[model samples]
Target chain A: MIEGAVWRKWVFFYIPLAAFVFLLLFPFYWMIITAVRPDAELYRPWNAPNYAPFWTANPTLEHIRYLLEETLFSTWMLNTMIIALVSTLISLVCGVFAGYALARLNFPFAGGLGTGIFVTYLVPQTLLFIPLSDIVRNFRLGDTPWALILTYPTFLIPFCTWLMMGYFKAIPKELEECARIDGASRFKAMLYIILPIAVPGILSAGIFAFTLSWNEFIYALVFLSSPEQKTVPVGVTSELIRGDVFFWGPLMAGALLGSIPVALVYSFFVEHYVAGLTGSVKG
Target chain B: MAQVVIRNLNKKFDEVHAVKDVNLDIRDKEFMVFVGPSGCGKTTTLRMIAGLESVTSGQILIGERVVNDLPPMDRDIAMVFQNYALYPHMSVYDNMAFGLKMRKFDREEIRRRVHEAADILGIRDYLHRKPRQLSGGQRQRVALGRAIVRHPQVFLFDEPLSNLDAKLRVQMRVELKKLHERLGTTAVYVTHDQVEAMTLGDRVVVMRDGVVQQVGEPLELYNRPANLFVAGFLGSPAMNFSRVRVAAANGGLRIENEGLRLAVPPPLAGRVGRYVGRELTFGIRPEDLRIATEADPRDLSFEAVVEVVERLGSETLLDLSVGADTMVAAVEPDAPARVRGRLRLAVNPERMHFFDPATETAV
Candidate 1:
């Protein structure tokens, strides 16, 4: 954006930007190249004559075909989609109401309650999973999607609540008050006026919750032991590697396919997601 | 249209008392304004009447019903907020029609009222557009349109025009008067701007620190303010104050201070004679001070050194040092005055105000 000569633009803007883009995209590029490259090149020694790690001459769909046919990739995809979606929905519903109450309602200990909710989010899945695993077993939800679906919200709700609390706070209180004076009850006012204005905020919360649950790992790893019940992050890593012999091509294929849905979700709600982060509520 | 009455209103927000024992009977079709500085509880009082804020312990009656426990929707009122608060998601038409829609007033009736309000506010062309697309003034009109479309029994404006620029504010002020005249709905407006309160309200309530200082017509409050705060709060350049002692000198009562001494007018001389030797606060408006001319009486004039001369086109304001106190005098624009100049300024004897120093109340 700096207006100047070519070298100034290069020094301040373009070169740094190009370097950043290259660095960020390198992993994805490597993933695609490894997934498509022939297994001979993938497993070839580095000292071989035609060893070109970054480039491949004969690209094939064998890894993708093997991932779909030989492994439970499709079932994992379905499991992840359902678990992520259901948890995101539960988190969003709880988050929106909890956020609105924390932001707008004048109740005793509301401030302390909001802080308490945030502190729960910070308990770290690494440590909390020990206690949660006990809780998961007590109900015997292991090896089923129910284990992940019910547990994902334990973390996702807090995250969505905090994000949505800040977002709801940024909205002007007068919108709801004006709606009330305009002859709508408090609930109606929220539905007709405040919530409509908070659409961007809610979407951003939902998108974040969706993305967080989609990319989640620990809970998916601990629970749901069945091959058909496993989520993508758990299924891809567990099934692809066998006793130190890595299935690099199919693993990369699993990663690439697993990330596509998240990418699509982001692209679809990109505008709202950005607006929600920047806190642009036009009066 | 129904009158709104607030009786024995008191509100305590935990440790802070936001509104004190307040009483006002806003008449049917009356435009009542509550004007004060921030934290003076004018908006709190308005919100209490709007049923947005609960009364800590009091009664608010909109028409004949005591609405202390009624919800805002049940209060049958409309309010215009300072930020406009137009639903950003809805089109202008939908924004205006939302109340009607919530009431289950069918499609055609909602359309009729929305269009009628849009026509009145001159916002028909932007009916399909969103709030963010409109200018500030247009958005203000849309907010007004939204309120008018509801046709509520009462209208509450919580500093609605404060967000507007100066020119647009003046324009809107006039339009609000015209709108009120057209609708004749009871209104309760709150603002920190004294000029707005003076121009717009049929009756203005001046408050300070959660207490109602005075309530009267705008000119009544301007001419005969109840206390020191009201006299100082209403005027443009503010009234000047000087601590002076009243004493019997020669034959009659005279007001004497470090910088000036002037005889009391005969009408107030008997009243002034009672507080002979005690010190009290003296107040005189800047506009009542003039450049002393040849015909000016000697005892009613004083000489001072002018510090700064500000010619504001219509009037000239001189910041002057009198004894140990700084005083501002608003004189005629054509007056020959300069900084560092020794100038004689005359005071209108009839316009002088006196208040007890301890009570700070007019004597």
Candidate 2:
């Protein structure tokens, strides 16, 4: 691949690839090691005689046990799951409809409206959350899962809509036209033909929306106050550390566990996600 | 079966007038083909008939009912697109049965019709396989199977065989003819291939720039094209034309150019008499020219040097230079003609065509 000599292959290709992989995986390795390290080894001084920061001589599950038993980690996991699933569903339905209309309908200003939706997705959540916090308070939804459930869709819908629109456009319009000629109405054609063809797109969008809401911190921190209502990212950080002190063991353990579901979702639908991104419909 | 009649059909896409004031009467059970170059409104007319496109101004009648306002589903018709448009996710059986299922047909009836159509198209072995699993020819058959299962009163095909390989295209064209004969359905097909138009159509409509140039039975249009476009578009080698001035010689009208001078045949002499002393286009197909023999009259013969000789197995084509004009002649393969050598060529007077240069219309 590097063209000629073995040294050239190592220098130009394999060495760079190895360095990139090491850089990417280093943080995950640190998190896993910290989550399993005993308290004695974790707090060891850097210059101490037997100190090894990268490896541990005695690995234990005490941090994970403490995270599970001492704090409301499981409650945060459940809350994140519910909020993410509901918001993703809400976003997906609206997104699929908006995407279909924008991509296929002949209405005026469809192009402008599509651009308008994409512009909404570009609005930074840091500023958007300020106004959203006001709305959440006015509706008396603070300190509850509904606050994030409703607000997540503001960004997620636009993301899903733009992605689904591109996917819907990639499918041949003749598939729908032939269906209509074959005695299916426009609605039926979309239901039986277009929707089935767009499953990969919908799955990719759903997974993305789910991951975004699951790891969201800004809105979760601003809106939810109760220990029971906080999602994983917010609760783990807020509960594990006090003003000037840090709980490294339980904090890393909570974070490591918090990311598992999202990782599983990605791995389960990786094939469809790639296919959706490439937008191929073979006939 | 039902007759499809279009009256003053037109389509406008913003500033482009895609189809203009087209009227045609397609009789019942007739395989009518709309043939033309790209953007010539042949597909547009077919789409209007299928109710896929809105008519800018006109009426489309199928079976005595005006289908101008009807959606494609309400009109009883089936279409096979050039790309096959087979549902990639559906199996052959489900794809064929989808239309029947949509119309709420009973399960048994749908199954029976799907099987029968598959049997006709010989795709019975692929009933459980998705469209992507089939070859191009097999996919084409499945597309045809999908249409026939519906048993619609009319069928519309938009260059359905153009996507196949050349050998497969010819094979499918013959099968399509046999299929139409077996079904006896009134069909409207669209294509740009002249050979496909000639071989497959009971009638052919040649169009250009969104206007119908000529429409008749295939051979009829070939023998009697109304204009220069139709004459040139319908034939493979294309009719050759040379601008020749008419002159009076010995009480008869003669046509002469830089290298050719011949008396007008008696059958066309009356039309040539008025154009004397004016320029007109002399037309002849390649097959209408041959090497001159002793029996041929000297007046109808001309001397030329062969510039190129193409030896096709069945016949040979010679590109000849006659003074300033060049012409191609399809001659017997064994004809003793050599490149750069002189040969006397004669024109078949009966097949000689003349056109008014001003209007480019056949006289």
TM-scores for all candidates: the values are: 0.97, 0.98
Give the proportion of true interface contacts each model preserves, from 0 to 1: 0.94, 0.94
Candidate 1 local lDDT, A1-283, one digit each (tens):
7997999999999999999999999999999999999999999999999899999999999999999999999999998999999999999999999998999999999999999999999999999888888999999998888888899889888888898889889888988887787778778887877787788889999888888889999988987787888999999999999889899999999999999999999899999889898975868
> Candidate 1: which stretches are off by over 4 Å?
A2-5
Q: Judging by lDDT against the true structure, name the best candidate.
A: 2
Question: What DockQ does candidate 2 score?
Answer: 0.91
- lDDT by residue for model 2 over A1-283, one digit each (tens)? 6599899999999999999999999999999999999999988899999999999978999999999998999999999999999999999999999999999998999999999999999999999999999999999999989999999999999999999999999999999999999999999999999999999999999999999999999999999998989899999999998997788999999999999999999999999999999866997
Residue A224 Cα positional deviation in candidate 2, in Å, after optimal superposition = 1.7
What tier of docking accuracy does candidate 1 attain?
A: high
Pull out the clashing pairs in model 1: none
Cα lDDT tens digits, model 1, B239-261, are: 99999899887788888888988
Candidate 1, position A62, lDDT: 99
Best by DockQ: 2
Q: How accurate is chain B of model 1, given as a TM-score from 0 to 1?
A: 0.98
